[model samples]
Target: MRSTPRKLSLTGLVALTATSALLLTACTDASQSGTDGSTASTDGESSAAPSFDPSTIEVDEAAAALLPEDIASAGVLTVGSNTEYAPAEFIGEDGQTPVGFDIDTIKAVGATLGLEVEIQSADFPAIIPALGTKYDAGISSFTITEERMQEANMISFLNAGSAYAVASGNPDDIDPESLCGVTVAVQTGTIQDEDIAVQSEECEAAGEEAVDILQYESQADATTNLVGGKAQVMYADSPVIGYAVEQTGGQIEQLGDVFDAAPQGIVVAKDATDLAAAIQAALQTLMDDGTLVEVLDGWGSGDAALETAEINPSVG
Candidate 1:
């Protein structure tokens, strides 16, 4: 199954019980954040030692030359991102500024092209189809897939996997081997949501109780659900699982190992091939010069960093 960025925030769903709603909301209220910050900063990024220097980034003449002449003249890279995915893209403390590693990555890309980046916050489902029209590019942890390639150019960047987590010591006796009849929490529209649907189907096919899949709009809510004993299990992107585990302060523990690794990419418009080439070139420069790894490392996602960037690579 393909993995998508999980936005962590303990938002209380209206349908939840009054007790759970309070518990979940109280756990995490902050949204994601970032801006055209020249300094290394984030709600969780201060922990990455030896702070990254954005001022040190230099423009790549060849990469800038690849930009479409019109865009080069425009002097701004319009980017649409769903500012909800923590450590990747999300609204910051001020409630409007977009902050996260993904924001920083795109900013570095803009700097290489010597253009200002204008990050436009939009819904996750709306970001892709509007590319080339509504936005110049997208970099919100889009997993490179054959289907996505048909819709837009997918430039490979990071490799990430999915993982499951349960309350510490598995106090609920949750079994990853068979989730039949167990509560499983996942963010809406994520690959984990799709995977759990299949698992639920399998249980019914085998005449066993199907999994009680709990869909939350925010991963923080899902993670909080698991913490509050409302869910027996929860699965998300490996980095997201790690972040949730850390943010929750030992309330949850990883269950089993991470699985289903895949390449996540930056989405560019199909018709804007020139812009796509320019983005790929800027990205390659980042990968080669260590800027990409430095930024990701600060976010605890350095291990998922890719050494090379590719365009529309064949998915396994």
Candidate 2:
């Protein structure tokens, strides 16, 4: 699974007594805003759409030559991102152009490589498998793992980890560990989904009732299930969990500190060594010139910034 960013006031989804009209409105709003179905900034910043203007950084001719002939000739770097992940990647207020730290940072990398960037929104789980064929790169918050490394190369950019959220006041008495019979919601195709599955298997192995895992195509749907009491807890990247809790007013609260913190990378196809190197060089350039830090700071995600770009860093 992949993660992105948001926070908004509680809309009473937790109140099962809420009218159908309200639920409809929630669905409508979610569909419009895309990720987490809210426009509220997770960082307590302005509601106005944040904009990123990558510096007019010059491209290194040497770096540009590393691109594959097809891409180099086209002069455009096509990227796939699950735009529903906010603060990281999401639909702008205009609901057309993509925005967020990932989008901005990738755009900056493209600028540094002297290529026009075309960000195509895709399913989070599908992004990885689509790389090389459909996308030149995948820019969603794809946590670098050994399993994924076998399929593609990951260039480290930022660090984050999994976190859990439950209804405010721990109403369900959910435990982050020992989740044996709990109903958990998570986005399909994410590491969180895999983690929960492993835990469920462990439960069954230990003679306990297996967890009831609820999977959704998007984190927004999973979050909605959580707030609606359909699921006792939700797991996502720390930033996403934070955003959900903050956005829901007092309806939800973070269950535990982030765990398994690791680097998230810009994914390149396994065979695309040259493209990966090019992106790594471009990211290093951004880091050296401070554009990387600027992009992270702009989205209130500076805390997760990496000091250096690593290609296929040890997941251990």
Candidate 3:
């Protein structure tokens, strides 16, 4: 018989939550320093970059109130998201229920604005197209890129960076340089994809066979390949790798510290200025009241937090 695909179900949600609570308690009490021993140079001093500024931007209530007449009358906003990204967006063990830092943050924002929020799950790359007349916005763990910014309006949220995951015991200590001739799996069209492309170029320049880059539609797929021994390393966001490692009971180890920072955000149609403004305002309220951090912390993503910022550079 073919085995069933690994999926999160409601029962799994309960188990995961129970496991998370225990892990959180241990983590909180460990007293060990929080730093992962990673540091970078800044003005001759080495320090870790601060997470995204979750409060540096705000929305003008007057402008927000000027939302399109249709939107104001409807009083509901439909958001597009892909639940494959854990800690950002994901389905609870109760497969039908959505739960994650992103879900909580968006729900809290909607509550603050008295707007009904609906989540529509779509493929990661299809989110932008799903917006506009059909969907009002998307809050997937989408990273802001110059190319994508040209197609939609992105409201910056979390700061992320690429990292690699390898089987436990870290047999190779898998650094980017170490990946020269190995097969590395990455999600297509993501910053991790770009990072691998850069690595491939560097490998070619060094006379090594450029790393064999394998593309997967989702992190879970890539991770499956890694566990099945089809791939040597998986390239993805650090937080994502961390979550996967946690879920696997440390069966995997993340290596080669953050290489590049990617700023994640919500995307709206180029013409949804009013909707974007309202969202910006709502996010500000969440930040000020500490609800944003609380929601993220609840999901074991205390590291994936962001500050509110104004919606400038209108989508149109």
Candidate 4:
């Protein structure tokens, strides 16, 4: 982790547009919901349809061999995810299945480890704290930050950058360079929340107006607010903003270039080195075999693919 200001993580362009149809809505409560993984979402059409069977991903005996005895015996890798970000992971149209690139990627990892994958919907902030107990893993697009590494092992796999978007036509005329005193919207419990706090503090320190940050439980709500002309701007992972822009039919536009490019990781318990090693090995197998690119590229996110996966990878 670098000493720079902590950035906010994982919010996206509006998956909900006034002009589009969709299967699910944003959920913000602390309580969690159950998903059967029974269906796929219809909202994210940005990528070519998945061309391969996720269940058919080949198992790597060497990778599977690294799993902890208890996990190996259970034969299931249960993942907890904040399933509201489009294109990465979100609830499918059926509202029961977890869908998105992240979901597919993890499912592939599980298949390689010869384990069934089960994903549960959780609030963005609640997923990590419940790791190792409620969830064996967290597959949310967890931006690798120094702070997070202290609590849980973060294995770097995919690379993503942060970006901002505003209502179409510069409606608020907001400037991303100086967000102080602006009304900014973001999802709760994300790195963005922490980032905005730090930005707001900078505003006060400079005797300027602090950013009126509106933290929503779901990016969907924050997006709705932005489109509804309530919030001036929003920021999140780049893929999400791109999804939102494409889905919204010109309702919003990216405010600036994507910045703070960083690797995202699968979160494993800090003490669960065995599990982490297994996951890293399984990911490497996929990468080596070209399965990683095939899966993510099918989702239109192949651009962010990493050549290698490192456990607790060093980040600045």
TM-score of each: 0.84, 0.84, 0.75, 0.85
Deviation from native of the Cα of residue 68 in model 2, angstroms: 3.3
Clashing pairs for model 2 are 1-189, 1-190, 1-191, 4-85, 4-86, 5-85, 5-86, 7-247, 8-247
- Model 3 regions lying over 4 Å from their true place: 1-66, 312-316
Better of 2 and 4 by TM-score: 4
Each model's RMSD to truth, in Å? 6.0, 5.6, 11.2, 5.8
Q: Rate the local accuracy (lDDT) of all candidates.
A: 0.70, 0.72, 0.59, 0.72
Tens-place lDDT per residue, model 1, 56-87, is 78999999999998889999999987665555
Counted clashes in each candidate structure: 7, 9, 11, 7
Question: Model 3 reaches what TM-score against the true structure?
Answer: 0.75
- lDDT winner between 1 and 3, please give it: 1
Q: What is the lDDT of residue 7 in candidate 2?
A: 18
On TM-score, the candidate that comes out on top is 4
**Candidate 1: C-alpha RMSD after superposition:** 6.0
lDDT of 3 by residue, 258-313 (tens): 65555666778987777777777777676666767777666555555667555542
- For residues 1-316, write the lDDT of model 2, one tens digit per residue: 3422211111111111111122422233322222222433333332443567765678877778778788888989999988765556666645467776789989988988889999998877677788889999988888887778888888988888778889889997887878999999877777888888889999999999999999776666677667767889888877777666655554678887778888888998999999999998888888888878888876566778788898899967
Q: State model 4's lDDT.
A: 0.72
